[model samples]
Each structure stands twice: as C-alpha cells, then as structure tokens.
Target chain A: MRSVLPVLTIVAFILGFWTLAVVPMNIHLAADQAARGDMVVEPDDARARQEVGAFALALGNPAVIPMTYTLDRPRLPGPQQVVVELWNTVFAVAPTSNRSLIYHGWVTLSATLLGFGMGTALGIALAVGIVFSRTMDLSVMPWAIASQTIPILALAPMIIVVMGALGIQGLLPKAIISAYLSFFPVVVGMVKGLRSPDAMQLDLLRTYSAGPAQGFWKLRLPASVPYLFASLKIGISASLVGAIVGELPTGARAGFGARMLVGDQYGQPLVTWAALFAAAITAAALVGLFAALERVTLKRMGMAA
Target chain B: MVSVDGNPQGLEHSAKTARSAVISASSVDLTFQTNDGPVHALKDVSLDIEKGDFVSFIGPSGCGKTTFLRCIAGLETPTGGALSVNGMTPDEARRARAYGYVFQAAGLYPWRTIGGNVKLPLEIMGYSKAEQEARVRRVLELVDLAGFARKYPWQLSGGMQQRASIARALAFDADILLMDEPFGALDEIVRDHLNEQLLQLWARTEKTIGFVTHSIPEAVYLSTKIVVMSPRPGRIADVIESTLPRERPLDIRDSPEFIAIAHRVRDGLRAGHADD
Candidate 1:
C-alpha cells in the first residue's frame, strides 16, 4: 500500500472529479428546463420550499415546478438517492423481493471466478504445450492472438446461442466466454517467462546431467514467475470483460448486465453508472487478490522483489 | 621404470614419470563445426594426472584451456580419440558425480541463499535432510562462511562468492575437483590468498584437482604438474613438473623455486605460440 499510494491517489482523484463533480454538473444542466411551468433553475426567491426528493429545492409554487428535475437524460443520480436505493435493494430486499444486488453480484462473481479458473488452467496448458513443441508454437500461438481479434462483444451472443443449441446453458456458456477472453495474456506471459533463462544458466543446468523435467522445474519455472504474475493480472481483467460480454447475449435478468438493460430501457442513467462502477470495483478486487497470491508464492520461492 | 618414492627431487627427470595415472588422454581431438569448416580446438594431446595430484592447464586466450577442462568435466564430449577419466567416460563420471566443477564465475544461484546453493548438489543426489544440513554447515565452515550461510549471493563480496562456490564444489565429497579458472576473475591479492588456501585444502583432503588458467604464476604456484597448451589446434607443448612444496605460503610465489617453474611454464607457452 505504501508503494502504491501515489497510484491510488491519482486514480481516486480522477474518479472523484469525474463521478461527483463532472458527471453530476452535466446531468443537472441537461435536466434543467423552464418547460411545463417548471423553473429552469429552481428559484429560491426567499420563498416556497418544495422537498424535491430528499432535498429542499425552492420554487414559486407546488404545481409550477413541474417535471423539469425529472427530465434528466443520461442522468447522474443524486448521491443520497443512490445511497437510499442501494440500501433498500441490497439489505431490505429478501428472497420475497426481486431487487437483490447481493444475488446479482454473487451470480456475476461466480461466473467471473469460474471463467477465470478455467481460462487460467487452459492458458497454462496451452502455454506449456507451445513452449515445449515447435508445432504448437507455429499453430496455436497465432490462433490465440486471432481469438482475441474477433471482437468479444460480437462473439459473446453467438457463443451463448450456440451453447444453448448444444444443450449447454446456465453457468457454462458464460464461464466459457470469460475463459476465452482471459487466456491470451497467460499464454504470452508464460511463454516469454519460460524462455527467460540466460545462456550461462542453461549451460550450468546442462552440466548437472539434468533431464528436461529437472531443467524446466528448476530453472525455467523459477525464471517465469514474474511473467506469470503479470499474465494473471491481465487475465483477471479480461475475465470481467468476459462476464459482462456474456450477460449481453444471455439477457441475464439476475446480474448487473440485466440491470444495465433494464436501466437503458427505463432511461435511468444512474442505475447503469452504478452497475458499471460495481463491475469495475469487482475486477479491481479480483486482480488485487491475484497480486497478493503472487507475492506469497514468489516470496516462498525466494524470487520475490 | 617409475620410482615408488614421492621425493621432491629426481621426480621429473629420473627413471620415469608416475605411471599410476588416473586420467590419461592420448591423441584426443575436439573439432567444433563453424559456419566455415570444422575448427579443431584440441588435437593429438597427451597428458596424465596422477592419483591425488594437482594439475593446471595454462596458456593464452583461445588456447582451448577451458575446452580441455570442459572435456574432462564431461560437459562437452570430445569429437575424436579416446579420453578416459578414472578409467571411465566423462559422461559416466559426471552421472556418478565423481568431480566437482567450479566455473570461471561463481555461478551461485542468485535466488538461493549461500547455504541453499551449497546444498544444491546434496539435493540432486537426494541426501537426507539432516545429512544435507550437516554437510552444508561443515562446508560453510570449511570455506569460513558459516556466518553468511543465510545470506543471498549478491550480498557477498566477489572473494566471498568465489569461496562459496568452492564450498559448493566441496559439498558433494567428489573424488576430483575440476576448476575452470575459478580465481581468474578475482584481483591479484584475492587470487594469491585463494591459491594458498586451495593448496592447503587440497593437501588436507588429498583430492585430485584439474585447474585451467592463463596466469603462469598462478599455474606454477598451485599445480604439482602444469600442462602447457597452445591454440589453433590446441595441444600440449610441455608437461613441466613443479618442484614447489605442497605447503604453499602466499609469499612462496616470490621464492626462487616458484620463479624457476614460472619461467619453465612461460617457455612452454611461448614454444606453442611460435608453432602457430
């Protein structure tokens, strides 16, 4: 935390201005209007106070200040309103109610973790194969790069439909989508790491009468640690992208993606922004967990910085 | 006939050199394939290292000093001729771990602590945990680095690192020690001190040592026999037996006996150069 404090500060500052100041100001301006007997900017002429939702906004008359405040398009929800709704939806809603962010978050997190695990396993297998074989390097490597070029947003829906046709539904299709998007970095990073042994080190290993297994386990694996961690960082972020992409095609009514769809239909911009922020936070947390695991493993190997 | 006595005098010139030789490479050849034709690095070389003897190979750069050492270490198989170490192939010797080799550099694994690096061979040979720790401790003390066992390689000085490497080589309890210019990278002062220490260590253990160096003084100071080699089809020009005593002091390098052997090594190397 001490070393990363500067980066955290810069990120926090940027998000602070963008979320609180820039987003809200634009929303207010866009929402402001004198139409339908409403004041463009609410007039506080030492006068009538109407509690326009959680806040006292001064206006000439009760009916005069019409629907102008509610006219916000691409709106940023007021902080207090979001807070109340979040509390109501998250804590207040039970199995009896449908507005459960916890359930939705769990759904999304499950898919992300499943896909991340599958992707990491497949990525490691492919990387080892490619590293050990010239044929795999010639064939699989290019395909991995090409796999990402096919625009995941476009591919996600097709994958969901195809898996549905194949009688595979529920979590598997989403996990597959997530895995597909998340594995390229693992392969690339691992390949580079596996090849990182210096000539002198290799020669020393040769002198030891060590077989390929011994050589790889002793030298290449140790050398590849930093690269593998680097790949994992990239992989976890891509996993979030996969889960979101999966949601679009599946019309997942229970997760954050489903909420985005509903918000877009109802023209509730704050709900969508809130969902986006939640996903970003989840992804950041996942990567942070990986960072912690990396430190522990590398420290044990005596290769930690 | 070779004499049975191990006297300092009449050892080289008398009836014969010791025939109870452990390593005897005769008409040995090594050719490496280049973009052009094959380049012969070693050819028609013949030499013998007696049991429990210290021999050094010395010459100028590209003299195949290192190549010869590598051949003996079984890291590189010779292209031609018969070469036997302890009456077995170098490959066989290596698999048996008959020799402990120290490279020109320390080559200690940076990721490991000094003790851990020393235990690498013990681990490879699969010693018991208790045995590994005991041997590592003993070797660390042998090299006078018991205090720094827990420290990383980078934390040690060059001289200390070199000593750690020596400890690593000695850890496995191999019969022969093959060192490739192990002290070549050290300063003159450090090299001199290590040479004396190595002589003492060798005398104490009675281990057969094969060392390669380009320094004539270093060769004369440490070796019981010096194999003078030349490049461009590297072969031995002379095998001068050193008359210097086994109990070498650092200042013994300044003695008349050491000076005379140094001159003999210089002459052998110059003769090889003239052939080129």
Candidate 2:
C-alpha cells in the first residue's frame, strides 16, 4: 500500500505528458476532422497542414485541440485511446478471435517460453562444460561472447530464411531466434556463479578429497542459484524482444509483432499502442514471477537475508 | 635422511614420547614461480608432528606457516624434499581422508544450515544420512553450538560462526586436524574464549593438531610445541617445547612459565625479521 502511492504518481506523470503531447502529434488529422464539421482550422487546407510543424499548427488552431484525443486514426494515439482499445481487444472479444490481444499475447508468450527453456538448459550445460574443462573455457566462451555482438535484428531475418529453406516454419524459427538472444546472458552469469567459490572454499573441498562431481553438486551448483535467477530475469525479457523481432521479418499472421505491423500498415495506431502495452505488461509479469521464485527459493535455502 | 634429533626442546611429549610421528616433513621446499620472479614460500622446512600433539606454527606474513600447513594437508605440492603423513605421501594420506582442514575464514556455505555445513564432509565421504546427522549433532555439541544447528551462518555472531566452522572440521572425525589461523578474524575477547575451548577440544578428541597464528600468547598457551618461522625463503628459526602441563586454564597466560615461552617466541619472531 505504501508503494502504491509512488507508482501511481509516476503513472499519472507519464499519462499527463502523453495527454499534452497528443494535441501536437494529431493536430493535422484533428484539423482535417474539425474542418469537415465547419469548425475553424489553421489555413483551412488539409495539404497545407502537413507542411506546418505540428506544434506550430497546433498553436495556430487552438480550437482543434479538443478533437485531437478523438481522431479516428491518430498519428500518436492518446493514453485513454490505447486503454479503451486494450480493454476492447483483451476482454470485449472472444480469446480465439484474430482481433483479441490475448490471442496474440499467447502466441508470442508460448514462443518466448519454449525458447527460454531451451536457452536456459543450453546455457547451463555450456557453463558447466566451460567450468569443468579448460578446452571449453578457451574455445566456446569467446565464441559465445562474439555471438551476442552480431546484431540480433540483422541475424533474425537470416535465421528465419535459412530455417525456412530447411522446411522449418512458424514457431520453431521464432523460438530459435529467442534462444539465441537469451542464451548468452545465462551462459555468462552461470559461469561467474559456478566459479564464485573463493580459493579457501575450493581448498576446503580439496582437503575433503572430494571428486570434481562432488565439488560441483555440493558447492558450485547450489552457489550458482542466485546468479542463475538474476540472469534468467534478463534472459526472459530478451527472449520476448527476440520473439517479437522474429515475427517482424517472417510476416507472421498472428502475435504481438504481427498486430503491430498490421496496425502500422492499416493506419490503426491504437492497435499498435495496445499491443505495445500488453507486451510490456507480459515482460513485467514474467520478471516478477522469477523474482518471487528467487525469494522463496533463497529463503528456503537460508541464502536470503 | 634428516633425523628428528636436532630439536632437543621439541622432545617434551612426556608419556607420549614413544608415539610415532604422524606427520614428518624433512627439507620440504616450495618455490612459487610467478610473473615477477620465483617466490621462495618455503625452504627446507622440516618438522615432525607426533600423534595427538598440539603443534602451533607462529610467524609473520609470508613466513610459509600457512603454506607448510597446506603442504601437510596435501593442498600444496612441495617442489623439493620428502613429506609424509601416517607413513604415506601427503597426497596418499589426503586420498585416504586422514585429516580435516579449517581455513582462516569460516567458509560456511550460505545456502546450508550449520548442521548441513557440518555434514558437508560426511556427505562427500559417502556416510549414511543417519550417520551424517549423528556426527553433525555430536560436533555441534562439541563446539557449544548445539542450539544453532538449524540456523544459517549469517544469523550467528562472528564467534559463533567460527565455532560452527570448527564443528564442521571436527565432523569427519579424522585423525589429524590442520588449521591455518582459524581465529585470526575474531575479536580478542572471542579469541581468548575460543582458545580455551580449543584446548579442551584437543584434549577430548586426541587428534594431531597443527595450528598457524601470529600471536605469541596464543602460540605459547595452546601449543605443546611451537615452531617459530621466518619470512623470505620461509623457514623455521626456532622450535620451542612448552614446559606447561596438559591441563591448562585461561589464566595460564599469566603464569611465569607461559610468559617465558611467549618471550622466547617474540624473540624468535624478531630474530626472523632481523635476518631479512
């Protein structure tokens, strides 16, 4: 409850800024719409309005300000318009409908989850190999780091085209892109976590005559949990971004990315804004879920303060 | 073969004078090759620790006191000379689980309870769950940390955490216990109390103990034999045998005999510094 006030204050500030920006951004459309109703508009010409700076045109036609929030196809949709569209798409329509945000969210989310699982498993396996073997440490780690530097945007389309040529289509290609994006963070974090034990701790294990397998299970694996969750949160968000970008190039018919592209092509900014907000919310929920799990696990293990 | 007959003062093992050497190092040398140059961490370091003897190695930093202890525990390889534990090579003795080592820090796993941390060695040694629990219980009680078995290390005081570490070392019931300044991080008051408890523990366990420290009183009060070492090509400068009886009290430091031994250790340390 104490935290609610500060969060609400921040949300209100962003909404207020958005409300103010709407008039300038949609001034040309609002002016055209107002002129149809015989209302006063700057220059009384739609073509002339586009040449004018949005802020200058908005200042010139103050009377059209009230109509900016109500434009049918706003250049930048107002916050309230996005909220209404979100409500209609998310709850007003059946989940199976192509127009429903839930349907699109589910499509992206399933891909994200599949990719996240594969990436996490692969990352941990690679990290263990690197930690235990000098060859993997020397050979794979540099490549893993170098792989991340190749822009995911440039790589996503290439991956889709190659995978498509191989007769793989739809979710698998998108999931592979997500796995590529997420695996690096997990690999780096797990390596650090698995190697976190100090020299003294390792020496203590050596004194016990513990085998490498015992050392890993009794010391390294348990030690890496906190670090694993930290990377997992970052990986999930990156995975979502990867899935959305993956959709952009493949011309996918359904998913948040498809909804965004469709909205842009069809001049429906409200649909794009709604999909954008839904994706942000999804990312937040996934990260929150991991954080809660981390707390519970660390608490049980007596690692948490 | 270097004989153990040179150190006349270190022969004060009374009734246990006939006991065989559990750990014997003759001309044990270790030189660490580094980017800067070769570091003579230990040089011709020789000592014999008889069974059930409480031996303390006291020296300043870089004196190879801890390094010698590490060599004994088979955590470090000697580049030269011969060292053995229980008539076997240090590596062989380690594989046989002949000793338990306690480090400077507690090094308790945050993810484990005190009991779980204590049970770590037992678990690795393939002890049954029931036996692990039993040993954990016994060691925790031995360290006066019986009530803290379920608590995490962070919840305890520094003193209590150190005790928990001691309990962990004792859990495996090994014949030899090697400690490298285990109480170096604790407060002086806690140090004194722990020192008393340690002597009692040594009496109860009858384990061959090798301790490293920088304090004179701690060395003289706790050790049956004190090996005073020097830095820079680290080697033993003096080996002093304590004349004190087996039964010792905390106030024994105030006794004339304890002070005399402490003074000799202090002189040995200064002489080591002067040589460099």
True contacts kept of each: 0.25, 0.80
Residue B5, model 2: lDDT of: 48
Candidate 1 off by > 4 Å: A1-9, A12-32, A40-72, A75-101, A134-139, B1-18, B268-276
In order, the Cα lDDT scores of the candidates are 0.78, 0.90
Model 1 chain B, poorest ten-residue lDDT window?
B1-10
lDDT of 1 by residue, A1-305 (tens): 58699998997787666444433333333323333234444444222222242123322333332232343453455444455556766778883355676677778788888998999899988988888899999999999999989998888999999999999987889889989988889999999999888766676665566677777777788788889999999998898878877887777876778777777878877667566666777788989899999998877666778
Q: Give per-residue CA lDDT, model 1, range B73-166, as digits (tens).
A: 7878898888888889988878777888888889887778999989877876778999999999998887889899999887899999999998
Local accuracy of candidate 2 as per-residue lDDT tens digits, B37-121: 9999999987878898899999999999999998998889999999999999999999999998888999999888899899999
- In candidate 1 chain A, what residue range of length 10 has the lowest lDDT sum? A46-55
What TM-score does the first chain of candidate 2 have?
Answer: 0.96
Q: Candidate 1's fnat?
A: 0.25
TM-score of 1: 0.83
Q: Tens-digit lDDT track for model 2 on A1-305?
A: 59899999999999999899998888888888888897877787778878899899888988888899988799888888998999999999999999999999999999999999989999999999999999999999999989999999999999999999999998999999899999989999999999999999898998889999999999999999989999999999999999999999878999999999999889888888999999999999999999999999999887785
